[model samples]
Target chain A: MSTLTSPDVGRRTTGRRGAVARVLAAPLVVAVLGLVTLLWLQSIELDSIEKRTLNTDYLVDRVREHLLLSLSAAALVALLAIPAGVLIHRTNSRVLRGVVLALANIGQATPAVGVVILLAIVWRTGFTTALVALVAYSFLPVLRNTLTGLAEVDPATREAARGMGMTRTQVLRRIELPLASPVILAGLRTSLVFAVGVATIATFINAGGLGDMIVNGLKLQRYPVLIVGAALVAGIAILIDWVAGLVEEYARPRGL
Target chain B: MPKPTTIIFPSMDVRGAASGGSATSGGGVSIELDSVTKTYPGQDVSAVEDFSMRIEPGELVMFVGPSGCGKTTTMKMVNRIIEPTSGSIRIDGQDVLSLSPDQLRRHIGYVIQQIGLFPHMTIADNIATVPRLLGWSKKETSARVEELLDTVQLDPAVFADRYPRQLSGGQQQRAGVARALAADPPVMLMDEPFGATDPITREKLQAEFLRLQADIGKTIIFVTHDFDEAVRLGDRIAVLSERSQIEQFDTPAAILAAPANDYVASFIGSGAALKRLSLMPVTSADLSFGAPASGGKRPQLDPTATLRDALDLLVVTGAEALEIVDADGTRLGCLTHAAISAALTQSSPTRGAGPAAGEGVHR
Candidate 1:
């Protein structure tokens, strides 16, 4: 019996060690990338057009706007999509669940640029429209994941919970939600990174973000500005993903 | 040579004795199911039609039948997991149907074949589920969890903080049993609780459960398709047929001796006589004090072991006689094939005398 179980114990130990290594490695990798980008930028001779877009104040302002748009959209998705998914699950109506899932599929199927451009065309272009577009673009992953996670809970486990005299609400809160959390957290992480990528399109609607640098650089043919803009957006997305990964690990129920 | 003597062992008849006669033992409460019927929506035929049985307090009644016999549905109705379309269920003379289902369930311990220990919770938390739901204080709940883990033979220090997946199948099932018994509910509903275990583990668990039942005496409705398990663990085995029909509701010895009808005899299969022996302890037989003629350190049997065990030892070792010993391994006497046969003949007169024997058969 001990021989049979020893392998599982060993595997679990290695898995924990892997997670710890990842937690420590992510920040170090991000820092190195940031330093390399700074060195590369400083090595080049910048022209007037490049200097205008790449100044510290201009760059910092763009980064702030970019972070604000993506983070808030991801936050709103977490708040709205999870409950909506749970409500659809609770209704236990196949038709309603199917409808919501189909709508979510369509939302995801539509390209991020199309969503941003189309929303701006129909509604007025600005920060609000861009925020709405980012939210719409990232909603599907979290919603789909919530439904999938809940559905995947073992029926036997659910029956036992109910049989033990746990009320419907109690079972959901104590059993179902905890079991479903890992998958849900994975979905949230995906959407967070997705929001960071899509928030770049907000610049098209006259919203100020790192995308402004890219647009200005492209029009004026300033390679330095465009590279810096693209690199910073990439950096933010990676860092957000790393932080979400840490949160996912921390928030997961211990037994799971 | 010394003549054989009949040694009267106290509690020797306890296994085959009718539970109704000793219903007042332990924390058990009586359950009365009166003419309960359940018909699924859109179906004309009732799944469990007019099913009725009075389970005595402290009785462990086994519902043994083939699949789709509606046995599970009948048991589920007691705890209101599955509502009956008609009729009623009462626990300890209290109308279970009238009470709130959730509140009613909290008082009835429930176990199932799946042995569903929550994957996300530690063993302690899973066992503490009911106590916490009842708003027990943290200290009280933790103490109860520890007590239950110990009752199920899991070390609290080693197993309490571990998740269900880390445990073996047998250990997980033990945890499942521990969790059901956490609040010490008077009535327990077990749906083939040991069905998923392998044969060896199942036997060990059955023995342990029987010992536990002797202590707690909780009125339990245990469902199983295995006739051998029913005979071994149940005080009274309810041989069920289609539509949850009670073909025979009697003690294990009574049913094995005289099955109510052809269906029951067939359900009992080829091992009726052997099954009966399993219900009778080794002390039921006469024993001789004479030393074996060719003694060469003969095999010994425990005093508490069943006659079936004695027979197995005799056959396996090909011994003419085996010594019976108490827990201290001191020789009580020697048992032979003749003594076992004599005991079987002596028990024949009391066959079919169990409480509710041949009472619930409705053609």
Candidate 2:
């Protein structure tokens, strides 16, 4: 009987593992193709023209800044939204959930450049302002997913918890969180990808991240530089998504 | 049930053992409901109405009838989960309505058919809910959790770290019981805790619960719609009719032997004789090793066996004298055909009240 059980558990793990693997596989191929194309393009930069040439060091720094921009914001949202998400779900307080959810959606919909511009006017234009704008832009996906995942949990399971004498908080902490984790993680990945893509536009403002390379390359008509910067940003988004997939896969409830 | 030919006499191994076992920690409290009524405002009829009964503390009593007989509604009133519109339920000579709902719940361990364990908490954490609510310290709560798991026959080490979803349905139910017992409350209310399982699992849980009750001695008011379960586990079964009508409340033997009215009789359904044997234990007085056949070459059996079990032995082993031994293996008595018959017919040769065997029988 015990042996009969581990296989069922194994099959579940494999199923989720397969999903993460498939998602990662596509991004891995994309990164490799982008890498080879960049290598070939760098070999043929024509002339000492007063044009923006691809500076490897600048490119690396911009990539680092965008990475920082997306990861820090996504992490913050995940931590805050998961608990709030489950609380709303267990209470089924649609009114409260709807309010916060609308705020998050508004945050996402309020154009990224506008947010950066507004934040720059209010605060000093720097990495910190850039971080705030990125986080705000990324909020809706994570918050919405957390709410939807938690709400989707089976009510029979919740009824079971109440009947067992679990307090309201205990039910959320123990039962609801574990069950809703996968869906919430999926949402987190979506938000991270969005933040990475949107962070490129923040360079239009003085909140200089790697978006500077793309914006500078565009103005100077430096085609190679622009292509490399855009390619790097795309690669970063895919990488963050792959990493999120790994974390989520590892953390999905064992029997899920 | 069609009445069985078996009439096994109840053993005098210890006559007053079962009844006197219900003293509990304090003096017994008789639970009463006087004209209690509950209507959910817009609902057509009241869920429960004018329901009343007397339940002694430490008693293993069950409320049973058809679905929505208001047995559940009535049980919920005791803990104030479902408030009664008008009635009085006194615990230890004090009116229960005088206390707050949370206060009342802290004193009552509640279990339902769905064993709602919190999946985030470990088994130990789930078991510690009520004690911590009652302001117990960390050490005290931890110790109590371990003790409760043991009481419910779950190995603390094997179970403590696991979440509820990881457990089988039966295991979850055991954990639910452990959680309910956390505060050592005098009253435990169960709403068909075993009803969700298959018959085999349900029987196993019921047997284990009965053995646990024997040890803990809590006053349990169990609500189930299953008549067989009511007869097997209840010290007294209270039969309710549609809309909270109290048809009868008496010992299982009395309820089966003499139902209070036609409603009670219909609720009793079929197969009374074999069920009666389930209540009687085979005693040394009733054991006859060499009755009507050879006493050897049969599968060995317990002399303290219920007539229901002995019938199976008689069929398979084909031996008259199955060894009647205690767990220590001392022969108590020979289980003869006569005793099995006596137990079923509601005929007690020695003592105690019987409905058909005496004048006080319900007419």
> Whose lDDT is greatest here?
1
Model 1, position A204: C-alpha lDDT score:
94
| Model 2, position A114: C-alpha lDDT score | 91
Clashes of each: 0, 26
Residue-level lDDT for B33 in candidate 1: 95
Looking at model 1 chain B, report the run of 10 residues with the lowest lDDT sum: B1-10
Off by over 4 Å in 2: A1-38, A46-53, A64-137, A152-167, A173-175, A178-182, A203-221, A246-256, B1-30, B83-90, B93-104, B134-139, B163-166, B282-303, B309-363
lDDT of candidate 2 over B238-271, digit per residue (tens): 8988788888877887777767777887888877
Over B7-55, each residue of candidate 1 has an lDDT whose tens digit, in order, gives 1112222322112222223367788999999999999888999999999
TM-score of each model, paired residue for residue: 0.88, 0.74
Pairs in clash, predicted candidate 1 = none
